[model samples]
Target: MMDSPDSLVYLDGVSKLYATPQGLLPAVRQVTLDVRAGEFYSLLGSSGSGKTTTLRLIGGFEIPDSGRVMLGGEDVTQLPPHRRNLHTVFQNYALFPHLNVAQNIAYPLKIAQLPSAEIKLRVEAALEMFRITGLGERRPAQLSGGQQQRVALARALIGRPKVLLLDEPLSALDAKIREEVRQELRELQRQTNLTFIYVTHDQEEALALSDRVAVMQQGRVEQVGSPREIYDCPASLFVAQFIGKANFLTGRVLQTDPLTVMVQNLPIRASAMGYQPQLDETVTLMIRPEQLQIAESQPDAAPTAVQAATQAAAQLSVNQLSGRVIGDTYVGQLLQVQIETALGRLTATVLGKASLSSEVNLTWLVSACTVIPPALATMPSP
Candidate 1:
């Protein structure tokens, strides 16, 4: 959260567990992460996935079972929430009931015992930062949800907290306002140089806002990578299924190479890996919904990329089933189509409705698929 270029916040082997009736329920199991200074990082997961717990741990509202929480490389695991110099903005914008916007923004400065003139200056500046200058006199009960969120943000920012903890602060607003505020938050983070630890279950929000994301599940990080890395090449089965629409075809490795793998007779392009597969190993082939395209039926021709794909053992092993469109849904700028092929039902996203007819032939380009070692499905999370 420090503005210094060399500073970072780290959670080394940080674990948070609860005493449940059955056993010690781990909410966050030995998470080790580094949030570089000035990065807009997100902790993305559903409820109980330990994202909020991570935020609370860094903010000092919750303690980890074991490990270190360091700020600017200084150990601060035992520090109280108030001593962490981080501010948290909740979904409901927990503003003081009796305080008006001006007082709410000024509250932190006042609590720090700054002079009245300085408090006024800070409050005005905070309001300006959020473009809510005229609403400073309005109490929380009198403002719209979006305005209330701004006030809460202003209150948190007035103290100039090193890190900003946003717990789905925009979730309560309408779609339009949510997008507006989302842009506002990102711009503010850019201008302020404050490290942000954002929590969210929404995939698009995470993809759009984060410099990097730590995708969580059942209290542990499954994959931590850039939006593109996580989406294009997921580390585990959980991550592939969690982040977006993915088609997985279970198969065994037929051949291996550093850049690609032949699985279940399908020539599957593998992710950028330091390790290659061994032949005959079990593996999962993953293709994103958008990655695949409906290839035009072709007569005999020389080997193209698709032809090379058609020749892969994986393609031969799996039954060839071109499908007809059973149904389709138009989602802004894209078409979500359901295809009933001989293999099974598969989903795809195309640019737009090519034809409204229920009969649409389907084939996928091999260039769009990749292989994930089947061992990952059962592998223990770190």
Candidate 2:
């Protein structure tokens, strides 16, 4: 598949193989992806899910076994790393210990044989661009992790590559500093208008940093969409589970219109989006924990709670379940309450201040749920 004219980087049916002691292993399967010019795109997955390998393929560090890699609409699959106009920043800030900050940033320019005066001007500009103006004389060992990362970025951007490939570069920083650097990286990308193809195993980092994300599993791209689209309307079970915490219920299709399914023989109202479901087909239902609402009600208290549950269930636009509050875990501002429903165990998130204990009725709007067909219900292991 050829990349669109707007794409700065394109990978078409790319695959990479490695020989391990276990035998020949496939690090990356037939994957096709595109990153628009000046866009921030991310390849996200778990360790060994082929995200880093995909980034390496884009940067020309590794060639694909059977597919083409195009940079700016030109084939670069057989090109050497130095021949590509893309630069990569590895997880470990690869800085020379012997060189000072300015020298390290100017190395690429020096290698290009630019004038000494030009090198000095660009090096100083790079330092100020990364907010490390006065640290030019300091060695990499003398700088903090964040500072070292800045120097690495300055060095990579000093040459003004067409695209930047980042391989889990911020994984080494502390949580606080990692977040701060995330903002800085985004700002820098905007200021430079450089296409960034970032790879990471951190789910939150991908969601927070990328304009679009390609979720990979077992060397294959499970889904590609904007962060919100990926999170709210996952294309497969792997994406639903990988992108966020999802509560799943095994069910069978009850009706295609107004979307209804039967979970443990109980009719569950759901939103099926544009999917056409055959009646009585077995399927899975997914809903976010925060979408569920809980209210304290005794199952045996004067039949009031039972009446309410029944009424809620009768409504075709809502799914209702009564359960016992088995336990609750406090996560920041939300309390994740686990409930033992009649069908099985389920979890719901409510405000931390909610009085959650004993019998409770769980209700969630149909619009907040997603129905997954049986084909996309299972995730292949990497």
Candidate 3:
């Protein structure tokens, strides 16, 4: 396949395996990716999902068993790390404890055998750019985690590499500090306009920091898209469940036109944007917790009236389900409520709290639900 002209890094059918005692273990399987220049692209997955291995392959730390790695449209599969125009900021920060901040930032320039005056000038600029000008003499052990992170970033960027690779760089900081550093990292990327390939297992971190995210599972890439696209229109059930909290309903297809499914004898309208379910085919519907709206049920309303209202709403491509609130939990700004219906226990997130054992009505738009055909329920390993 031809690499995109804008792609700074391209992986063509890359695969890697490790020789384990159990036998050969596949770490990455025929993964093809195109990372455009000057974009924050993330490799997101849980542990053992090949995200780190893929990063290493691109960084020349690990060579693929098959396929090629392209950097700036040049094949660099067998090149060493220093030969490539890229820098990696690891999880541990990997700062030289013996050296101070300025010395650490100037190490790369010194290695290139640049003039001493130029090295000092660049080191000063890096310290000022990372807001650590006053801490130039502070060692890594004396600095806070966030400060050390910034120093490492300053060092990596001081070399002016074409791309920067980050491996869970904020995993060591506290929640508040991590959030602060994450924003700084994103802003830094934008200011420098350098391409970034970040690897992280945190879903929220990946979503908040990346321009595009590649969701990986069991050594393969399942889906790749913008944060909103990955969340709203997942390619597989794994992607949906991994990205955020999802409520699922199993039902059989009742109609193809505008796609309607029957759950517990109630017609539920769902979006068939990426899936096509045949007549009477068993399928699963996925709706995000935030997409569902809950309201108190009228005490004077009859069961027949509720049923009639549901049917009427279905005709307009809306889904209405009535149930008793079985669980309610206060989660800061949002209240999570679980409803026990005939179909199953469905969870929803609302702004206000609902009392347990109270009857309620749940409604969601047809576009809010994604239909997952059985074939896509579990993606097979490649």
Candidate 4:
């Protein structure tokens, strides 16, 4: 992957393993990743998904059992952490309690044997960069969680490394402060134009802050794409379910067209997304919850009005289905409605408040449905 022109960091078929009482375990499978210069990329996954281990390998804190780690087209797999040109901001902040904020930020510069004047100048600039100039003389105990986080960031950026590794740095902060800090970190990355490699399991944070996201599961990358692509056109059933809430419909393809598939004897249409299914193929169609619209089903309404309205919806490529409301849940800004239909139990996310009614119509765009392999769709949970 490093053969590319502007790629800054590349992991070529990297893998790491550990021996425990249970036996040998693979922490990171044969994974290959390429991060471009000045791009915000995130490794998003749950616990034990090998994200933290992968970051450590790039920083030279952990060596890969096989394959190479390259930086700026040069091999650095065997180099020590100190020999690498990158800095890490850990989740715990790892600040020193004995030293003041200024001293903590200036420690790296002092160790490099720079002149005192240059060290002082860089420390002052870093303090100002993080908006903590007034807290320079304060100790870690005297600062709030947000303030201490800024100090850690200033220390990491003071040396101006080529790459910055963030290992769930905002996980320690509260929700309100975490959002504030997330915005600050994004703005900081933009101003410096530094290549940031962030690791987190929070989908919202990853989607909001990253230019691209790499979703990992069981030590391997499930998918890598922009937020929209990952959410809309997932490569596999696992990916579609992982990125967000999706309703899966299992069916067999009776016929195929350039832009549509006949699933379970029903012709379903989709926008031009390059989808081509073979005849008699069993596939699972995925539709996101937010894409569905729910309206009260009127049995006594005139068929003419319903037909006209249905035709308009179909012109926009919307698919219609009749279902009975099984349950309704209030979740903040949206109401989660579960319905029982011929396709099975489906969940729809309706905006604002919705009346808990018995009969309803579910409307979704055909372009929103993604088809995946049938075996994976029906795979039993482990």
Instruction: Rank the models by lDDT, top first.
Output: 3, 2, 4, 1
* lDDT (10s digit) by residue, model 4, range 1-382: 3357788989988999978899989899888899999999999999999999999999999999998999988899999999889999988999999999999999888878899999999999888888898898999989998988999888888888999999999999999999989999999999999999999999889989999999988788778898888888877777777788999876666556534556555666544352466776766788889988888888897679888887886756778888988888999888999998877889999886556558888888877877764333343221
**Candidate 3 lDDT over residue span 1-382, tens digit each:** 9888999999998999999999999999989999999999999999999999999999999999998999999999999999999999989999998999999999999989999999999998888888898999999999998899999999899999999999999999989889888899999999999999999999999999999999999889989999998998888888989999999888899999979999878889999986888999988899999998899999796669888887786758778888999998889999999999878898999997799999998989899999864544454344
Q: Pick the candidate with the highest lDDT.
A: 3
Candidate 2 clash figure, as a count: 0
lDDT of 4: 0.85
Worst 10 residues of 3 by lDDT: 373-382
- Total clashing residue pairs per candidate? 8, 0, 0, 0
* Best-fitting candidate, scored by TM-score: 3
| True-vs-predicted CA distance for residue 269, candidate 1, Å | 5.4
- Residue range 80-162, candidate 1, lDDT tens digits: 98888888998788999898989988988988999999888878888887778998878889998988998998888888888
**TM-score against native, each model:** 0.86, 0.92, 0.94, 0.92
- Checking candidate 3 for backbone clashes, the offending pairs are none
Alpha-carbon runs more than 4 Å astray in model 2: 298-314, 354-356, 373-382
TM-score-superior candidate, 3 or 4: 3
Write down the lDDT of every candidate, Cα atoms only. 0.78, 0.87, 0.92, 0.85
- lDDT (0-100) at residue 169 of candidate 3? 97
Ranking 1 against 3 by lDDT, winner:
3
Query: Which pairs clash in the backbone of model 4?
Result: none
